[model samples]
Target: MNATATFDPFSPDAGTHQGGALDGHALVQGDYGTAVLGYDLASQVLRDKRFQNSALRLMEEFGITAGPVHDFRARSIIMLEGDPHLRLRVPLARFMSPVTVRNTRDVLRRIVESINADLDDSAPVDFYRGVAQRIPSLVYCHLAGAPASDAPQVQSLSERTLSLLTRDRSLTPVIVEAYDELFAYLAGLIARKRAEGLGDDMLSYLISLGDEGKLTEQEVLTEATSMLEASSVNTAHQVGLVVWTLLRDREAWQRIVADPELIPAAVVESLRLFPRTGVVSKIAVEDVELEGTVIPKGSDVHVAVWSANRDPGRFERPEEFDLDRERNQPLTFSTGSHNCLGQGLAKAEMEEVVRHLAEHYPDARVVEDATRIGQAGGRWLVDRLTVHMKP
Candidate 1:
């Protein structure tokens, strides 16, 4: 809108642009097409169906022009719109609903405690590997009714498949192979569920839906695959990010320790500051205009979630952690019809992890010298996070 602000959001130093306006414009154009940099504009673009997810195109860019992987991406829930999208999204939403997440709290707490039990708090530890990276897959196993023994493979597959989001063309082969293994793994799990008879888990529910004609066999597999790919990796990093953020801010950590009821808000504030998926790329299906800029059809429109979350126009002290901040809705999980269906479960999982740390390791502090947290390709990644649980 203002001189077509120019900067690459994917650059390693992209994080340098975390203010209300990028070059005094909420929407700017560059070689990467348009970037929505303000909260209001980002919200509008995310909800507008005319702007579709660019994941399918991204796959093609990586040379996955045709095949099962491409076909699946083409039909995945993120790429769908209207009635077709609802049909796929509704089934998964039922499992991640507020009631279901509330019911899963006890189980989440148990899983967190079990994972922490093996950690020796006598010395500083790599919290990222020891705790953050491990919880989500176990949670997935619980939801899908798979054996807990399958958690490691589930975590690995999710990580490799979603690595495509890193926009690394070099990971094309790894992405394809990961999806193939994912499909096979889901098929085997589905078959095993059938042999054991249907259970109450999400996968069993999908299988029953297929048997009842509510979904086709392939549709069932697609739904399961969608759940599996999205189940682990992001949440794991986010868990580490939240812990890293909370522990580093002694005031906030102390507040959370004093009142465990503040854990949820504390987690939200941390999410705002260091969202894992900082960029949500979309494509214009038809000509679209925003803030005086016309995005031609088929053009890329990257929503800079990291920038929007810290927009001084929307946040009082955009860079500071404020647990009492009202209506603190960050696009970390996104917003709109296509917003994360697993967000409730993910938040519950994070909250429980923080709660466990607060109650058991109140004196915990981040060992910053042994930690590495940075941004790349517009995503916040945790390379290492060391914490002295008893210090």
Candidate 2:
């Protein structure tokens, strides 16, 4: 085995290694455990079923050793593999597939316009809270057949439930309470859908499957809970990050504003640059050999997706935002069977937001002094993104 390089993937400075020699070293050792740094290696690890999502272990580490929260994480689609994973993943996948997302474009556009209509474009606005954070939950409500009035609570629940990624032990109570609320909310929503007659929505679709014996009652609830928890928080910050990245790049912004068709590539480039989920933590289920290194069973392996996205070995001029880059596939949404099921929908959401801005606020610019973006626990986040929409 080659001498393993050492670095802290969670450190604030970790992003500085992007496009550096770290990309040459496929594997690196850290206090957290092994980190797959190279683009190829990261791809391999993400696709290898020998490694499983560490979310359940993470919850246990956060002191959620048992309960509905722990039990849910243990059986969630992310933790399951093989046939079991497919059983839960396929239904959700059908809803978020490219075809479905394309059909939903009009709805997405309307939602973006509706939200932008409320923005005070005359001054620098808190774009993160005002626009980005608001869109996903609204989109969720539309998909789940819930009232738009439930958006705020849905947003709050998603954020708090996924706070486990922050690795903050202090949030144990908060995380627990959030999951409890999430379960109750999902139960009520599922019951309401049944009582009022099923409609043409994702939640209703899941219920229909349950009626046909395709999924158990518990499985139906689990699927709904999984979709709800994973839906909002990440996509919200990513929309902010993509907008913040694009608006700041004068050259790119000018091109996007001139040719609206480039909005998708522009959004993708931004996703490559500032992926919200920067690190995907997995646990080795069995001894695995990679590049001659043996990752023993039960070992933690973190894929530094931010590093892989900017790997000089994989992307030409990897640090630059090149709208013309061919095969601009990044590890932001992950890969393989366990990859993000909502990615197509997430990308569509981002593209619509960008299209709205380009069409209505071509002169928009990010207010850097009032905006705050940073990374922690290997994840990039938008704390505050202030934008002068009409400036």
| TM of each candidate vs. truth | 0.98, 0.98
Superposed model 2: Cα runs more than 4 Å off: 3-5, 20-23
Predicted candidate 2 versus true structure: per-residue lDDT over 329-366, tens digit per residue: 99899999988999989999999999888888999999
Model 2 misses residue 309 by how many Å?
0.5
Where is model 1 more than 4 Å wrong at Cα?
A: 1-3
**lDDT (Cα, tens digit) per residue for candidate 1, span 1-391:** 3527577778898887765577678887778888888998899999999999999999999999999999999999999999999999998888678998888898898998998889998999999999989999999999899999999999999999999988889999999999999999999999999998999889999999999999999899999999999999999999999999999899989889999999989999999999999999999999988887788999999999998999988999999999999989998888999999999899998999999999999999999899999998888999999999998
lDDT of 2 at 171: 98
Residue-level lDDT for 286 in candidate 2: 98
Note the Cα lDDT for every prediction shown: 0.92, 0.91
* Shift in Å, residue 388, candidate 1: 0.7
